[model samples]
Target: AVRIVNKRGQFMQEAVPVGEGSMAAILGLDSDKIVEICRSVEAESGEAVQAVNFNCPGQVVIAGAVNPVNKAIEALKAAGAKRAVLLPVSAPFHSTLMQPAADRLAEVLAPIEIKDITIPVVANVTAQEVTSGEEIKKLLVKQAAMPVLWETSVRNMVAGGVDTFVEVGPGKVLTGFTKKIAKGMTALNVEDAESLEKTLAALGK
Candidate 1:
């Protein structure tokens, strides 16, 4: 439940490089289909495009070079995709294009000591819980260019008896995705003072 915002770090700083990347959200398309779309676009355009985020069922985000991303959007739309919209982001995060950033991040993290976790931390790269500090450090580096297995992580949590999700961030994006991921689950968010009060009221706290 760690939120990294307005933070200065090698990973965050390197993930965003100027003018060489773009991202887009592809809705109403299965993960496999989106992967296919990305592959096709990359092959045709000779540029990189990869599925970066599995937000929920039928909702994935792709990232790569700007031209190829645009190409994929057009191709996806032509292939009967319900929506393919460009995201307002500076870099093609979680794609192979970010490998350089990941490499730099690994160096930066090498000296930082990671403490053993008391609770299970689900990794974005593996969609599984990791407890070893070393493993966590490695995964954090890899996650820069690796697809975020958010859907799998959520499903795993649900299967493990998690029925309610509270998003503590600046936006309700994750809350919306949670609802789409599990219809029977409860999703709530607290992004501001008002939202905090509302969440507290809902929780009867």
Candidate 2:
């Protein structure tokens, strides 16, 4: 529903640690519940892992904590994952471990040139629409440490008259997120050729 053009350098790469930890869509559950589950698993596995992606109303994506994401890795193994291991992104992203990264990002942004935003861009930091490029940059740095406010962002998009949510790029992940956050709002993706055709056809209607 939101489109923030990657300022020259930002890029969306495939998520590393693809099948390492077990990430289940724990529906009918809140973020606190998911954090508890991650804690439970971490207690059993002696690893530092916690909920990473707070995507929607009832879903929470668990990632590494501290001890290790070994317990989740084991669960994935039992679920037929061919390979599983810890991720290699310095600190466990989205966790408190990234506080240092956030600090580093802040330092990096302090001297970077910032321009005004020409279009509406949804901010993951505040889950609000940000029109000032400087604010957008600041938000991006803060997002390195703060939790992603995807649900609120999606809600804002719907409230702002964006009836159709089109996720452009690979994967139906965002599309699924739109469904979870705004149940009545329809979501479509352009991940593959078939999906693109279907999306185009739907748009024509």
Candidate 3:
């Protein structure tokens, strides 16, 4: 499943045009197939659209100009996609369409002081652990316009002996992804008081 983090309000405040862009979830298709479908649409309509998120094995998200995005969705559905639904978003994030936003974000981050992280943080763009503050800052800027490598990041964590995952957030999305990425791995989430108690009990604490 593809989960979208809506930042349209902030995007509009940052000067991204309204209604000119959109995002859609392409299910039941691998990355290569999704890319192929996007390419076909681009060739036919000459509009920019591409796969932006590799969320899991069989799910991906595409973003770009609204026309092209909708075109790709229709093509994907015709090409045998299980589902292709337009997401409620204001901007085409994580796609080349966001290059302007990414550039502005870089300027916004330039003045901020970033301290070195004590623990390894998997970067969204490279799907690798980044330590240096400088590298982290650069990656953060690039990540705004680059596809999120979430699946690869999870694989790296599993390879590094992370068999148990605790998602501390408002949703259980990551916990769900964890189960799909690594079968039999303990996956728990703490989103509220009740969930926190359940997680604590699961951890025998």
Candidate 4:
């Protein structure tokens, strides 16, 4: 089972839908472990399963693995899912499955005029902060087909003296990962008007 932490407390009482296709988190395993597991599962099941999202330490979210996924797929099946399939993404992503996508992204980015980074944006590919525009561009392209090092990003941010983390996305996914990475740090998520107000009040803004 995946240990999903709710950083903002918003997810503490939320109901998330089982998205299109199938998704499962390889629990008690790192990215490499998950990849190996996916390969084995795929070979036996003859399905197109691959590691997709990297949320936090020792957790790797995998999609595809449709056939064997039923045996090891988390929560969803118990929640009444019959089977999960590979997502409709261009490629499998992150598991050496998206080399083609990476190549394509490289081609697309080669001619684009990228602007310099004005702020310290963390590289999703490396989970390290980068301020150089050129490096950012390359990293961005790679990120499309690479695993997100969110665990590293949060750990590094805490180590680098970030006491507060504010997530501004459609889901509270990043904040949840941050909480798992840095338990001592203050983290918040702002996804709606109420959430925004709560965040401002929490920060005493």
Worst ten-residue run, lDDT, model 1?
1-10
RMSD of 2: 6.7
For lDDT, the strongest prediction is 1
lDDT of 4: 0.63
Q: Can you list the residue pairs that collide in candidate 3? A: none
**Which segments of model 1 are wrong by more than 4 Å?**
1-17
lDDT for residue 77 in candidate 3, whole number 0-100 = 87
How do the residues 115-139 of candidate 1 rate in per-residue lDDT, one tens digit apiece? 8898888897998989899998899
The CA lDDT at 132 in model 4 is 81
Q: Which stretches of candidate 4 lie over 4 Å from their true place?
A: 1-23, 30-32, 36-50, 63-91
Question: On a 0 to 100 scale, what is the lDDT of residue 151 in model 1?
Answer: 86
Worst 10 residues of 4 by lDDT: 1-10
Residue 35 shift from truth in candidate 2, angstroms:
5.4
**By lDDT: ranked, best first:** 1, 3, 2, 4
Task: Give the alpha-carbon lDDT of every model.
Answer: 0.84, 0.64, 0.83, 0.63
* TM-score: model 1 vs. ground truth: 0.89
